[model samples]
Target: MSDCYELFLTCPKSLEGLLVEEATQLGLQEVREQVAVVRGQGDLETAYRLCLWSRLANRVLLVLARFPVQNAEDLYQGVLAVDWHDHLMSSGSLAVEFSGHGSGIDNTHFGALKVKDAVVDKLRTADGVRPSIDKVNPDLRIHLRLEKGEAILSLDLAGHSLHQRGYRLQQGAAPLKENLAAAILIRAGWPRIAAEGGALADPMCGVGTFLVEAAMMAADMAPNLKRERWGFSNWLGHVPALWKKLHEEARARADAGLAKPPLWIRGYEGDPRLIQPGRNNIERAGLGDWVKIYQGELATFEPRPDQNQKGLVVSNPPYGERLGDEASLLYLYQNLGERLRQACLGWEAAVFTGAPELGKRMGIRSHKQYAFWNGALACKLLLLKVLPEQFVTGERRAAGDESRSAPQNEPARLSEGGQMFANRLQKNLKQLGKWARKEGIQCYRLYDADMPEYALAIDLYGDRVHVQEYAPPRSIDPEKAQARLLDALAAIPQALDVDPANVVVKRRERQSGTRQYERQGSEGRFLEVVEGGVKLLVNLTDYLDTGLFLDHRPMRMRIQREAAGKRFLNLFCYTATASVHAAKGGARSTTSVDLSKTYLDWARRNLSLNGFSDKHKLQQGDVMAWLAEDRGEYDMIFIDPPTFSNSKRMEGVFDVQRDQVQLLDLAMARLAPGGVLYFSNNFRKFELDEGLAARYAVTEISAETIDPDFARNTKIHRAWRLATR
Candidate 1:
């Protein structure tokens, strides 16, 4: 073996800078970074030092030979040229790891087999014995990389990758890789913080990877000290005496470092199953006394009074893969931001996430951001110094004329496409402003898909703006959609002259069954606005549907005008906004029926807000079931069912399109002799069946219900009036 040789240190992508810095610090010369590999010149002892101390390296490969080869025969010949007997004994087992493919070596498995065959054939010819292939635990590990007819053969001195530090016996779901975790700590400046005796925390720690790594760094403990198996153990090229001396020195240093006073390293996890694994990992790393993990939710994680007040809080929360409902996760992000602002006053916050759109929900300004990869998924690491000046402009401002805050989340320098959207919003607002002002409407739709490229519905609820983006089709490029969304968000604050904090955004897609009624979050924050002279509470963040339906404003107003001295019935009366208007119109009595208890509670609050107490009634049950059981007659009725429902309380699935006839017949049976029933639905493709229209006097009133705010989108909903002949 040569005294000095070429060493290739492999680490996770985006961490090459840290590894280069580390190698340079360790006295390795000519260190250069390329993707995930760092090339350097070092002696055997320098390689040994890296294997023992590198917290960021996945493997240390010693380059043995390089050649130009093509096809399996050429590859076999090239690998055979290396003197195999000098590395390992002929009787020992070996493992070959092949990466990349070119010039007829199209697959990794085939290329690795060729290299293995060549090595075995050479050893057999030299010593009359062949080394057996051992994939699980090999005596010698070989690495081969082929690219564009060029081959580089190397010996993997670190087996099973240096990342397998032997501390993590169990793992939680989506555990951050150990090396990547170390890279995050290094990038977040944990070394400086540790030197100053400041604290470190991972609120969403998975199996204590960050906690263990942080403690190891603070105490100067070698990362691979606890590992039992290594490729160099049985290699003939390894110097036994030198390795022994280095190993002993590492053990002594680790022991002394472990004895230092702990720098507060703590973690918090909501999952109880993850807590034990985190504790177990810390203990296995010989850091039981230095690192601690407790069970807690993200919203309630706060630094203890006994702990360091100013430090860093870093976490890897879920990235929202879009397979299931994401409403709760949005609230999770929003609440996380709120908690960080409330509790972590002077600390630093670092959040790593794969879904950058979900990151926008946090509402906190990131002063610095770095891009990294978790396997194949592209991710972002956002860093923010939690202080008043660092907060996103207009994040928590309370004012009437809130002049445009900084572009929502630092939008890309105003593009011409963004300027076009700004002009469209201004035109729509001016067109609707006179009508809205004359009618005394405090809440109205300002723009509705006015531009096809920007598929959004912008609504004004007094001072707050609610933006709903329709999910784009699969054929659209994701980056393009994201750019368009950012452009639209950037244009909103400037066009409407409102604060960005007052803007709440949500993605709207076709709902499956009862998912539309599912709770997105529980912020419990409400804004009271007037619609047709009735006071109602609207929540923009908690659920998919705001409490009041702006499209049905004209219908609610008509109910108020026509229900004088008449008994009124509101079916599927979500929040009872229409029923409140009826009560204000001197209805003899009003009854509201719905299947959700939450909406029933909201309905009660709305009635209480308007001083209409005993005469108005709220019924919580399946509206169809309630209609079938009701025996009383009413002079006026409104039946508006959801497009589809699979609620557990319902006897069976309910589809408005398929069951409208039976539903109308049931309501007609309960109608007084001269009473009228109004039916409405939001199914865009709904067509009224002809048989029911022939049986009764049915009038399509969809056009009459279109108000000025919703006139641009004529297909918003369809309405009908029916009465017995």
Candidate 2:
């Protein structure tokens, strides 16, 4: 009976703004963007039009009910409150999709089961027959979201996601999602370019997602034309007459658009097998005449000799998702860049990649980078014009400068805030330089987020400087953070008298457990540096943390001083820097435990470099499990656990704040009488449990553990020496 209904259009993450624009363009009323979804008010025709025409939407859902729901009972009753007989028949099939978690329904499967039970109960009570559950092809699909104790139920107008346009019968390994491909095209201004009669090409098209989506946009083809199923198709409330009329109108529009001059859309693929599938998908989408997919290597990709056209070259290139994928793919990216530079001179390029670092290897400066989500992977769509002037010869410019007269090699002038940050870095260097020289220290932290505006840690590994910019809060403008990062990078080389090439930039985000230890890349270019009179290997580019922790310099030194003629144990030892120091200081034997084979290997190399043999052991296992089994007593022990880790290798999630008491108890049990256990963690808000402190002789030596190099920020790591009461 309602003329219009509240509707929600679900989209891939990071495309809310784009979807909002699309909804506005569709003339939907009260259009607003929410998290990963757009809300609007529209009649049945408006909903049908969006379901047909929207290229960026995943699903068009019609909101049916909303109410407070705390437990499974509340959810079931709330669902029952909606008259199921009005929307679905008792004999029909239905499916419920559950997302998010809350008070009673902690798991999606359980939540879905409860919703299903409620629907079945309501239907059976009314008509003596219950609807059957169909996961694959349901007559009716319901979407339930439990967010912040409120449940919003919606009927999925599009049975499956609109992205599954029914045209993609075949795909290659890691093919881009259709809606994601469309989002990338829109972000790259493909619609505008197509409007001006620009051609479209994909040199590395995987199953032709980009090309097909581009052709559909160019010809105004309804994306859902080939999709056979709709949620309302079997529903009792569906106005079949109205729906048929809308479908005929959409078909007419598609036919009229296709009659115009065909768009120049071509997809080139190196894989011979993928060509057929790509072509099949294009033809199925009814764009066979508008787009072409051909078997061709990236090296041979070029525009047709007769066409003489310039347009956009968009691609969703391989992002090296697996191990060993990067070793070969890095060169692929570089070669792709070369081929584009040689073949397409006037064309603009857009690359959608989950690995931005590999995109960086292309050696092309991206003019705009928009964040998008390819499924769960956070990816970026990089837009750049393929011009000779945009290419860099040596080191890339720290920042884009508009002045042509300025020397390309010269450092760009910093902003006012950047100037102040530079001055502070210089001052810190002056203050720390004397101490580092006097102590014969080759590596140390020069600045630690000294200026809040420039939240970066500048560490000196001999001549090379590692700069890690902390990811700013969501409240801060990303452009402002990028500008500040560039300012810091520009300032470091000039301030420290180091070459720009020696400077490595990395963005540091708050990480949990093993994620902090995961390798960003596998270059494994190790740099030998001296820390606390010990030689250590530190890699700046391959991982988030350099193999060595400069803040723990004092802790390692303390271990060395106390480890003479004593047994040393290092728990959660990454790279075993502490064990190396302990072995060098005359420990009877040293044991280092870590879960990662890569870091364990690095730790072995460190011990060998320090001339400590296998007598000093390195064990690979979960530290907690290892500790529970170990009966050996150690006079000196170091336990440094990650803040939180939900690694599959471990038994359960490890929370340093919650489990520290138990962890400390286990470590203390392994310590001999009067033996010292240096327990430390980098979790900023970590609080020592009162119960554990009361049980043991715990002394908070956090202040004393910070070295002079990290003097500016004493809370880099919290340390305490504990022993049995």
Would you list the C-alpha lDDT of every candidate in the order shown?
A: 0.84, 0.83
Q: What's model 2's lDDT at 437?
A: 92
| Model number with the top lDDT | 1
Q: Which ten residues in a row have the lowest lDDT in candidate 2?
A: 401-410
Model 2, C-alpha of 114: deviation from truth (Å): 2.5
Candidate 1 local Cα displacement, residue 564, angstroms: 25
Q: Give a tens-digit lDDT track for model 2, residues 1-725.
A: 58899999999889899989888888689998888889989998889888888988988898889999878899999999999889988899999999999877889999999889989998884437789989988999999999999999999988888889998989898888888888889989999999989998899987899988888888878888877788888878788888889788888888998999897888899999898898888888888888888889886787662357778999877776543343345446665776666677668999888777667657578999998777778888889897757764333333443222322233334446757877888898888999989888888888888778889888899999887878899999976675566556656666777765577777788776577688888776899988766788889888888889888888988888888999999999999999999998899999999988989999998998878886799999988889999999999999988898888888988899999877888888899897889989888898989897788888999999988877777778899888887
The local lDDT score (0 to 100) that residue 429 gets in candidate 2 is 83
Query: What TM-score, computed on C-alpha atoms, does each candidate reach?
Result: 0.65, 0.57
- Tens digits of per-residue lDDT for model 1 on 45-100? 99889998898899999889889986789999999999888998889999999999
